[model samples]
Target chain A: MSLQPLACIIPPDLLAAVAREADATQRQALLDTLQLDQSFRVVRAENAARTVETTRALTPRVGAGTPSRSIYDQKHSTATTPGTLARSEGQAPVADVSVNQAYDNFGYTYKLYWDIFHRDSIDDQGLPIEGLVHFGANYDNAFWDGAGHMFFGDGDGQMLTDTTKGIDVVGHELTHGVTQHEANLTYSGQSGALNESVSDVFGSLVKQYHLGQDVATADWLIGADIVGPQLAPALRSMKAPGTANHYDNQPATMDGYVHTTSDNGGVHTNSGIPNHAFYVIATTIGGNAWEAAGQIWYDTLVDPRLRPNATFSKFAALTLRSARTRYGASSNEAAAVKTGWDEVKVRVR
Target chain B: MNLPGSTGDPSGLPDPAHPRDMSDAGLHVTYRRSGGIAGLDLVAECAGSDLPQDHARVARDLLDAPADEPGRGGTEREAAVVPAGADRFTYTVHITDGTRHRTLTWSEGAVPSAAEPLLASLGGLATPQRAP
Candidate 1:
């Protein structure tokens, strides 16, 4: 079966709380909103399945009126495929800015792996990408499924505009598939949380490289553009998770933590810890995340010793070792990892 | 040697748990009675073992008596949980202790899920139940 983003990742409460509105007018509005979302999921899924994968579908096949920045919607049930459920450059392909952004983001992703990693595709085996954009027309949020594709939902004018409004989010979803293949990290508890963190690290790095933004200039805010005015929080904040979102939720740092099943073992929330760790590491070294920080993290992921259910401590140790192994015992790469861990208060011990 | 016989429904299926046993993960039935069976024999060939100890001693004397032993003519059985993966099936055959009159069962490799109910047919086994 194709990948299905779990019900847990995006809590039903957002929709439920809206549905419970006492005002009759508000309730009807919420129902209409939710109905639109469900419909998009169905359509997006049909698209992902129709094509072998997203990148391949894009390759050599310029669709009729393909949005310069088009959004797709993949309707999936769980994590299982080469997933890319949806895409959108901006507002809509008709909207010049949106289309241009979407096309550029999509193109950059294809280019990044082909040039730097020399990976033919997501799977390094010519695996296809499946993306769904403008999901629900105004639904909020975007996610990558083990289903092997991604799905992007437009924000409700208040929370988020469109998932593809940003390139980092796109990279974030694709990176989930990468993490799945390399570590197959169990999607629960701490391991699951790390899975999310890894996605953010790579996702942000992709954007950094594309924009030529350095460690200091990068906003380090994941999904800042994705969130709309009405929403309190963006999808997640790597710099300071809880702070970015409107909710008084704790920061993604380990010291200010929330342990619950709210976000798939807090994959979205807790990912902040390791994300911040990488940010600190990249910022400390003063360059691209893909260089030292991304390489060490990526190398650790493919390490044979990595298990399906590894926590932050376990992952930190692995990165430390990988930095030393790749750059040498006392190289700056290794020291940056040490400092990175120190900043996160997760001792290299 | 071919061990006298090899014909059966599941003669060479891989064991789900740990294979590498004389019984081929409980699929092969060998004559290992005190009558001096020199080597392992298949269930069908078990009739004329080097020991020639007789089927009753090898089948009944070794395993627990069928709950319906005596007049009822019933067969004994045991069940175990599936290990690790979702697809494979296995069984833990019980051994009967002559002195304590106790039954001890051990887990064996992938057994056909279909073989469960048929195990009851071992009863009235005027013939040997070969490695199926």
Candidate 2:
């Protein structure tokens, strides 16, 4: 059979004209080729923009506190990390949507910390943020690898989708690095649950700040976008714990604390208790969550009084102290914090 | 074919609570994965004869390997400590072959290179377990 001319060489207008006169099968083929060609043009444009942004990223900055971010493609292998650098700080979007999302989310998280808390990166030392995406084949998880890097997996498409698609998921993983630098909360028992809760709190705040959403407008659902057909809605809901999905067993109050050794003493399950407290506090304070409720939580995270093994009650007390210290003893913020703990059945001294 | 005394549940997964410890028997492997952002508990199992030949060999070798074998990417101390990152999965594997049996557990960060393929294969078969 004689070879047909390459579709890439044909103009779209000519292709459309030819398709109109062709048989049904040939017409469908031409249409698919045209769509593919259009996608290639879009990708080419994105690559050009990426080149410009990469150049800008390489230029020296006047400020020292700017975020230094890098994203890597794992190529569906879990053998090693920080695999192939796909993008860097200030770089334009790349062909891979996952890389672009990770890069943008990192910037959002950095902006929140710097603009609101004046904290530099995860370490407050302007440490570089590294993210790895497409980790493992059909991998369904994301994590902070204690070693200062973040890893995300392409979900199995049944229960979970792309982990990088969720901005809060990115924030949640990165907050683990923040927690590491500060409280370094032990990842077991109440302390472990507290660690998980802190990540959720800041993760939700990052989403809220990025969207410019107030407490009333925010959905307060974590992993909402990442979930798939098998698990709908979300992984967890700070506003109403235990109601996010079929498997969500999060308890909204200390009275319902789960007693188990699995999942690091049910860290993800029991985090609902503290997560609800933060939600209540933020909603009660009646404004932008990051401005008041977030501030108190952030203060407690970095406070010297916050121990590595802090319990729910201990963390509650510290939040009350933080609110009082920052917003005055009689301020509504402190009272809101106190009320949050009380509602969660966590007695603060 | 099922093992001589095989009593797997309807899904072919051996009962977790009453796993057989028979000596000089066919290969049996059980894998449990937990944690992650969704906080799911997933488990899978397969008899050696049911697995691909290469996977069965690897599973048998894993059962024969020493728990403290070097080059597994993590020491005993590291295994005991909580991994630094959030929403990462923790894995546990139990393997049994003729005259050999071993159980190994590790977080995502400490997974051995040799276990990757086997884990991936088994993870594909995993089903979420309802909370007890």
Candidate 3:
């Protein structure tokens, strides 16, 4: 009488076989039970598949503390990412210069995170670093696809050129992946600006670390090497924010915050506020930017208190907290953090 | 509309009573690309007659399609709500056919396949401009 027991004990195939020989009423019940059991099997299979996918996504593809990098060439087409494998981990340089730049820069970024922060790759799980170069003809931009890949454009030979030439640009895009795996900041409005600023911070740090430059020697410019004649100088200036180029409209302080519908509510424009703050903190600390200053920012990035929708004020306060937590309350690092935010007119309580 | 080679008419016979309006056939398109890593704004404007016949057709078909079409990316509301990607270009395309006008905005990768040629054509014509 109990269909539950029948559904559980009898396999759907056996239940169907039994239904063929049963009485009409019994056969109807058996068929219904078989249908229910079949649905359960589908649900179970789907759940199992989902579990496997989640595990696979979280599982590190390479060994801990080692970077697994792959560089692909798009071959002047926007059709597919990572179009063809031009280089792989521990492989010799290829014929194409862009491929080699991407490969080397990816390694540089990995070294910075690993050597300084002692963190594994982006996800702290040895997530494979994938780079796609030569995407589209004269494409003029570089970006993280938000799905575990970095794409670099060849540039229009006017406003920008050879995006792979900027090591900071590579670090910047890859840091977007790091941010994606961390706070996963909402890429709009104030939080979006924070996301951009974080990228700029780590990006400059990567360059600084590679060059063995102290805060004073570091250029603190985002895309210095990549800009062409049309948009000369650099893409952005963390030290001076709005002075990168003629078209650079970044604002260094809260008083100059630009409110607009374009550029995802001025993410790139307003990021100058935090970018300058980092610049001030690094200079105020007066040593390698990647030392104490970089540690605090990285600490704030992975801190649980840093929310996805964090505003500039929220992020500033968390950085202060990170500074104090890492250093004593009266430590110079914490004081520098406070002074940096105050200089940028961000009130961190 | 009636024409000697017309195949759109439900009847097999050519009808002269409803001639296609030549004025309405003209298309005006404005393309703007913004929000790249360099934060450059580039703009280009063109008339349907200026583009190749195939590209003009694709532009017209893209403008005619509904915003919710699968290949049209997504509705404007959705596009505005979801973040596309970091440092990726955002494109705004406006098309006008006589009195009929439609505008579409999409992040780089979400653009409709049909609009690729039109965008490629316009991108070549684009000049650097500041965002308004």
Q: Each model's TM-score?
A: 0.53, 0.77, 0.79
lDDT of 1 by residue, B1-132 (tens): 000111122333333432333321222232210000000111222211211123223433434445534321222232222122110112222332323232222111222232222221221111222111
Name the candidate that leads on TM-score: 3
Q: DockQ for each candidate?
A: 0.00, 0.19, 0.18
How well docked is model 1, in DockQ terms? Answer: 0.00
The count of backbone overlaps in candidate 3 is 0
Chain A only: TM-score per candidate? 0.70, 0.82, 0.82
- Candidate order by lDDT, highest to lowest? 3, 2, 1
Candidate 1 structure quality by residue, lDDT tens digits, A33-80? 677676666556545533433353245332322223333333322222
RMSD of 1: 27.1
TM-score of chain B of each: 0.22, 0.71, 0.74
Alpha carbon lDDT at B114, candidate 2:
73
Which scores better on DockQ, 2 or 3?
Answer: 2
- What stretches of model 2 exceed 4 Å from their correct place? A1-65, B1-28, B46-49, B53-79, B95-102
Query: Residue B56's C-alpha lDDT in candidate 2?
Result: 66
Q: What is the interface RMSD of candidate 2, in Å?
A: 7.0
Where's the lowest-lDDT run of ten residues in candidate 3 chain A?
A49-58
Error of 3 at B132 (Å): 4.2
Q: What is the lDDT of residue A64 in candidate 3?
A: 63
